[model samples]
Target chain A: MTASIRQMGVITAHLIRKVAFNPAVVWLIAMPLVIIYILGITMHGLFSAEFTPVKPYRIVVALPEEAGFLVERISRAPKHFAVEEARDAQEARQAVFQRQADAAIVAADGDEPLTVIAPPGSIVLEMLAGVVQASLEQEAQQVAAAQPPVENGSREESDTGARSAGAADGALSAMPWEGVGSFEYFSIGLIVMFMAFASHSAMVHCVQDRSTGAYLRIRALGVTRAVYLGAGITSGMLLGAGFSLVMAVITWTLFRVVWGNAAAWALMTIAGAASVASLSFLLTALLPSDPKGVENAGGTVYSLLAFFGGSTVPLTIMPRWFSEIFSWLPNRKMLDGYLKIVKGAGVKEIEQELFGLAAAALIMLGLAWLVVMLLKREEV
Target chain B: MATHAAVQEARGQAAGDPSIVVEGLRKSFGKNVAVDGLSFTVHPGEIFGLLGPNGAGKSTTLSIMAGLIRPDSGDVKIGGHSVIRETQRAQRLMGVVPQGLAVYEELTAAQNLDYFAKLRGIEKKRRRQEIEEILELVGLSGVAHRKVAQYSGGMKRRLNVGIGLLGRPRVLLLDEPTVGIDPQSRRHILDSVRRLAESGMAVVYTTHYMEEVEYLCSRLAIIDRGRVIAHGPIDEVRALAGDAVVLRLPFPRGVLDEAAKVESLQNTLPMPVEVTSGELRIVLPQGSRQAPAVIEELQRHGVPLDGMRLESPNLETVFLSLTGKALRDGKAAEEGAMA
Candidate 1:
């Protein structure tokens, strides 16, 4: 018993000396900080009006005096698009098809109204078609009612419809995070990546202990396997968890990202930190003798998770099949959980994600334990 | 005279039981047998050399005895505790310096000792003192705080020996401790082993170097092919080969063949005449009485001989006489197989 305690003490001290004092820690923290700052500057520039060009796109108008009401309404679009008159429907269609104009509006009176066309799905054509259709509808309604008496009565309903439509459009266009910046989401994931790398790199020494015969020498001292592995995982979790917390602080200060409720986010970070550490340990255990195998496997897994799990794109915009597949990955669950809390989602919203992260943590830890046992059994 | 007697009494009181005992201990890795029915006892206050060339099961035997790996069958008792039934007890009683230098090179000598000392269950108060004493014992006191990676090969070997002593174990097992070491470091390690034995610790030392065994071991075993071929006191084993007349002579090549052609000299010489590297070796079951006849025959053959001398057999001769091969040759072959 005394010998086992001594063995654990020695191993723990060795782990701390090597990992906590290693020069790589400096770069692990520094690289992420540099990336976060650069991304923050870049994102800010993209959103700033000084750097972005904003102007009403020009559209071609084609109509005769017989359709004066339609022409007038189309001309009245406020700052959304400017109207340019074409010689006829033929000229307007040519302009629209040739990409010389955003869209062409062709109006016909006393016949089926003609609208010059192009395929949908083009952002420019979609916006042009919306403007033209809205103008035509307003003109037709006004002519039929011959009145502006009900503006107050229907104003609230129209406003609500416009807001809902705007939200749906934003969800389709942006990466996840409820129309907030991608930097906020990417910064969090990058920070988590740093923690994972740092922890895995540090814990690789445990594998070295085996290859170098330090582990065998210590085992002869009668140390229990638990204390030895416990010290290792403990060291990894502390380093990974502490690094992630620092990243959260940096994210909040530099990017103005809302990390949601402080208490809830802290809880999620703790769970995520444990899961990342266990994953690293499990990966190190499963890999062959080479240390690079661990690095390759861990890197490949992290990259795949980040790319597919709505961390790179909004989940709602993903194809239906991909949503089903990526939803099973831990990264998606973790990001969703983090996003929910950051977006002020309540406990009810994040419970499933929290459980999923926990389950992942359990599976990884269980596999790590199994590997340690197999190694110990081989010693005997 | 009375004071000398009192010192002797005090020394005997400090001495412990035999540090190691093995009975019918056997082990194998898959189909290849490593240690086959090996049995030996190492008494306290002696450097017991388990000598072999290579693949002679020296390392496998040591591993089983040291509690690092379990024997496939049989019993290993360390300081009166059964290794299999009471592993912790066995471990606490013995410290093993493995075939490789297993200390973490990144850690300082003091830190390494303190770390292992804690694992050996030394109290915190005594741990620092033990580290200091061990460092001094190994002559590493001046550089205890320096990183081990920066240390010389000799310094690292000394620290490795020091690590094995941290527990103050009743028994110490050193597996090829001086392999690849400089002469100065090897001598220092031999001196340390002598000192440890003088202080009443039973040590099981394994090495392929025949001279190391001759210098330090009080009792020894010469193993071959996973079995002990010859084992006893150094002098007794040497005597087993009887008297060998070794003649260092600047003699012509093929002198032995030429000498053997003489009809009058053939029956009168020693058991056999062998030539190696310009030297003639004649092993006589009796003594060197046939030297004159051998000299005359060499002269008759027109073989110019210089620096003629005769000496009795040593361990090399004993090993050769018993196994019909040199100890070192066997070790070389084994190492080749391992490589």
Candidate 2:
């Protein structure tokens, strides 16, 4: 294991020197910053003008200890919903009753159903109730499947084992935040997009190695194929993730864009790096060891992922089917998570996006391994 | 006192002990049969050469020994470690200098050596010293800090050889390491390989140039169409080549119609005669004894013959006489190279 790690370290250094020393790397990093600035300034007005062209529905929420996860699930994810924390259930209900807030949700703490407060015939009333009922119904079914038929267990709809795990970390503080500015949104989107491109560009080393027979040389020098490939992927991931973080810092310092909590942004950047690196590895391994083939395939995949995933073209301008179908792309997931962070969401709120990115990395890595094994078998 | 000299001595095994054992190797690339039941062994402190025309499976055989390709039926053992079953350990005992330049162009020569040394599991502290010594050995110490992209072809080839010298393995496999280079650089590489063998490292040298094999290797195998046509010490292989002498008779380009003259010679002369690019060669069945009869016959055919020379049995002669094809068959070699 020590020898493997040492080999990985050496291969990483080789890759870094090979990739970072090239003059084109300067353009690869600098171009994105320029594009983000220009596009942000150009598209400022479009983002400012929402479809409704009215104030967002102000939903005053009261989390009774255990229901923070459900309220965050329901209140978050939609940029159009603005949230405010009510001090207590009475205050939440009174504020809506007195016409100060559009709606209020008093979540169930333990053994008690949630309460909803809204004016009659108000759109917020029906929307909030319907979302909360759907969540409660899902929770009810989970409770039913987890336990035997106990009449008293029905009231156990409080924060369960899974939801309470986040409590120790602290409450899910969905701070009062406004929507992202055009510059901030574009900066995050382009950073994610360029990071993927950067990973693909980093793979030029592997292509050159293969053509020059350096890969076979390295393997003959006692390094396994897996170790050589892993070193490349890990090194590219670090370089790409570091580059994205630097971009975030630059935007935050220069354009005054808030990328949410630092820890969350860093995690999201690492996750994005893993996904892009694995995608590059799989593409290289699956192709016919030709640089042009890898390049063309990567270019097509990157372009499509960005086009439909809100990086190249905004989801607002995309067709509904595109929005529905391609929204699950890794790039799309990254952009969505980054936009939320820009909107002041933290690690807890973007947990699913983080999980999705991690899962994508694992799946790509697994597929790359499978392809390499098949090729080796055929060679044998 | 330097790390390279010390490492060389410390890692050096006893000379004349077999370090490579290739047994019944068979590999077929979709029916091409790259290496068919080939076998050989090389001992420490000896240079074993494999000579064959293009596509004679020289590179493929070296690749199998380097653990890059898996043979269909047999195995290569590096100092008792199986290249197939214990590939990593076997690889650690051997190094491969590939036909192409494997050094990274973006990195300095020293940097390339240092990175490969590290990947070879040399500790960080010893890596700098080892890399410096390697640069000195490859005659690149003066320009070690320059990127390989800026180096001349000979310098790049030298660095390619230097990378294979990283771990001081028991065996080294060099597949035409000096294909196209300045004569001085080629000389330096040959001297370095000699020094390596002196330090008790077994070297497997493959080349198209027969003189290189005669100058460096004590034993060699002549492979033809994925099979060993001749194998043994230099004298033994030459003995197998027989006492048949090659007679080179030159003629002005336009003076001889190659096709008509070749037909005329084949029909009239009672010897194996072939027309090459610039000359006609007739192999004397019996040494210089048959030379006069061949000359008289050529003269009787109204063939204008320049001063002819009788070339005795050598590696090239052995290769041609055994394989029935010139060692450097120009057209076939070009096509093989392109492939």
Candidate 3:
């Protein structure tokens, strides 16, 4: 057993040396970091208030008598809006056309209670319309509250209505807090995606060794099959974990991204590394002893996983069925667990995701072992 | 003092029990048989040559002895360890230098040696010393730190042999180690093999080059159709062709119309005559006594003879005598049979 371990260590060390000197590996490590940096810096403003329009939205009210109430309600809302009273409908239209007002609210003489006119595709105009509608709802609620309860209606009905209103209010207040910047969120995705793809270097090495006949030479030297396969897995794990930790440190130091619960973070990193390494081993073992074919196949498979596993897009925006399928993927679980940690979740909150990652890693490793055994039988 | 002691110990171990015993080894690939009930042995201080054509199962036999493949029946024992039952021990007693260059091209020569040495379980302190010694022995000491990719074909071949010499196994197997290289590198490799045998190690060398077998091997086995057709010392195998001398008489392009019509030449020469495109080959009993009579007889027949040459028996003729075909023609014949 000691001899086996030592042999494995030596093989792993040699593989690491070979990969470190490879020019492709240097570019593989650098490309993702540069892309993340550029994307982070460029899209950082999109998630902040600074990127919003600076000028307050100007509103013109055509009815003098009701203009005061509308202006007060608009001012009380959580948006930037300036309300001005117009002398007539003609004047309000003129103000809107002249760019004095972003939108105009006129009391209509027809069945419709109000008319809102604004420039096409104006976000501020949309916000102003929402404020007007909310004010009308508030007035109707006040009027209903002042009226006596209907004798035909039961207390359950009134209670149900009150609870529904309270639930709506709760939903409005329960929006996710802006704890992490958009760049930081996307950076995690990019980092995990790239780290997973980096396992191709190990795959390429395996294929090259076989094609070059180095594998046969080593085997003839009495290195057992188990030792060789174990060494490959260990090398891949080291690469994945090493690159991830380095990226994490850089992003944290430079971008001030928060990483919560050190223990959870460590667990997630190890699980992610094991998952990718095992997957790469299985992939390389199943492929023919051709370096180019292994590389092309590995790239295609990893890219597909990255796309469907929420590494390239947010899982929340994906359809329900797609997200369900994505949840079973190792990278998805890794990203989910990482996000939870960054959101200050404890180990207990992410225990299921971590377990899923572990299970996936074991399955992949089992498949890799079977493949190695098959290859060993066919080598001679 | 320590290095000298170590060398003496290695030499003693090599000489004490170094022998390869192959018995009834059989291997088949699906419908085709690669090695069919073949066996041989090499004793210490002996360079055993495996001479055969391209598809003669020489490599298959070497691979089985190296423990790279399992035999269908029978077994091989290296220094008293059975290759099937105790593979690790058997492998430790032997080293194999494959036909192709197996050194990692991306690594420096030193690095490649270091890797193999570690795998061989050599002590770290002695590994560096052994690597340097091997580099010097292979004449690669000047470029030990250069990557193998930058090395010439001869340099790479030398390094491949050097890697096998690490840890100094009792028996060394070289499978056509000089297949593609300049003459200088070939000489260097041949000299190295001789030196290893002199140091009391048993060596098994395989090649199709008859001259190499004649020049370096102490004893040899010629294989054909997956069987050992001949085995013994150089002189004994040569004797298999008998004491016949071959004489080639070149005539004008169309002088020799048919071999059967040469009744006069056959009556005079007391041997069979074969008429080819531009020459007539005559086989006779050894000695110059028949030469003057044959020349006089050909002159009497008005046979147009431009020039004549005489040859003695060797491995190539022995192969022809055994298989009724030349060694160089074996590949083409095999391909034709397959077709």
Per-residue lDDT over A167-209 for candidate 2, one digit per residue giving the tens place of the 0 to 100 score: 1112112211125677887787788888887787667577768
Per-candidate DockQ values are 0.35, 0.44, 0.36
- Candidate 1 or 2, higher lDDT? 2
Residues B156-190, candidate 1: write the lDDT tens digits: 88888889898787788888887666677778888
The top-ranked prediction according to lDDT is: 2
Measured by TM-score, the strongest candidate is 2
Candidate 2 Cα misplacement greater than 4 A, ranges: A50-179, A378-380, B1-16, B247-310, B329-339
lDDT of 3 by residue, B156-240 (tens): 9999999989898888999888876777888898899888877767889988777789988878999887888999998899888
True lDDT of residue A264, candidate 1: 74
Candidate 2 chain A, run of 10 with poorest lDDT: A160-169
Q: Which run of 10 residues does model 3 chain B get worst, by summed lDDT?
A: B330-339
Q: Report the CA-based lDDT of candidate 1 relative to the real structure.
A: 0.68
| Candidates arranged by TM-score, highest first | 2, 3, 1
The lDDT, on a scale of 0 to 1, for candidate 2 is 0.76
Residue runs of model 3 more than 4 Å from their true location after superposition: A41-180, A313-320, A378-380, B1-18, B53-56, B224-230, B235-339
Model 2 has a DockQ score of 0.44
- Candidate 3, residue A341: lDDT: 84
Clashing pairs in 2: none
Task: Give the winner by TM-score: 1 or 3.
Answer: 3
